[model samples]
Target: KIFEGNGAIAVKLFPSNVNVTTTLALASGKIPWVEIYADPLLNRNVHEIEVESEASKICIKVENLPHPDNPKTSYLAGLSVIQLLKQLSGGTNIVVGT
Candidate 1:
């Protein structure tokens, strides 16, 4: 079955999939308009975000391969979390992007 809706509905129906939206809302201080789609045919997890303002417009899209041992989560996502932990622990002084 395929599911589609706004962020609130996505949260209710698919809590595990709303991490990006939650992070965006926290970082931007605004709840973003969101569209969620559940497609069984897709072999990879895909996320797309677009933001526009008076000064600039930003668009980002990421397609992540599923982890070999854990099909429910992406391999890249796991690596990202590890990297974040490392950064938070002061393992690196370099910071990229805002």
Candidate 2:
């Protein structure tokens, strides 16, 4: 996909695998160039992100394990949602780093 300017473009290519890119774009206000690779030989899903600017560069890599009950959902993904819900409900009353 050729992007003329800046925007998230993963929806058309990989709709089911776009949480990371979408969250990053919304939080950072910078559209990230996204690339998805399918590896049947691997047991987990992998995401690698690299951001470069004139003064700084950031690299992030995440390997998410598949949920035992549901292969379509990642274990970490569900856990994160639960954590977010707990935080929003004020059940923990603890400040956690995002």
Candidate 3:
């Protein structure tokens, strides 16, 4: 059951070193979930994700990589600025997912 199940996932978790909390939260990764923290060498540009469904909760982390086009910024940097401006300008939320 460990190697084969109806549900399977592959995640590359870095050196949060590890976590006891997620072990309990996702127990056996059965309900479909995992957690991780970034350990990208000495990088500090942190990124986080939180996912939850009726069955389980998962959290992930990564040290954000800077956009090659802009070392001081991540790709989302442009999108974020646009989003904020949209918000301030009263733009609407375009529905993305169901």
Best model per lDDT: 1
lDDT of 3 by residue, 1-98 (tens): 12221122322233132233344337655443433333446443563546677999988775655667776566566677778878877886655399
Top-TM-score candidate index: 2
For candidate 3, list the clashing residue pairs, or say none: none
In model 2, which regions exceed 4 Å deviation?
1-7, 92-98
Instruction: Write down the lDDT of every candidate, Cα atoms only.
Output: 0.82, 0.76, 0.50
Cα lDDT for residue 19, model 2?
83
lDDT of 1 by residue, 1-98 (tens): 35554666766777898888888888988776777777889999899999999999999998989999999999988899889889787886665598
Candidate 1 least-lDDT 10 residues: 1-10
TM-scores of the models, in the order given: 0.74, 0.77, 0.31
**Over 4 Å off in model 1, which ranges?**
1-6, 85-98
Candidate 2 contains a number of clashing pairs equal to 0
> What C-alpha lDDT does candidate 1 achieve relative to the native structure?
0.82
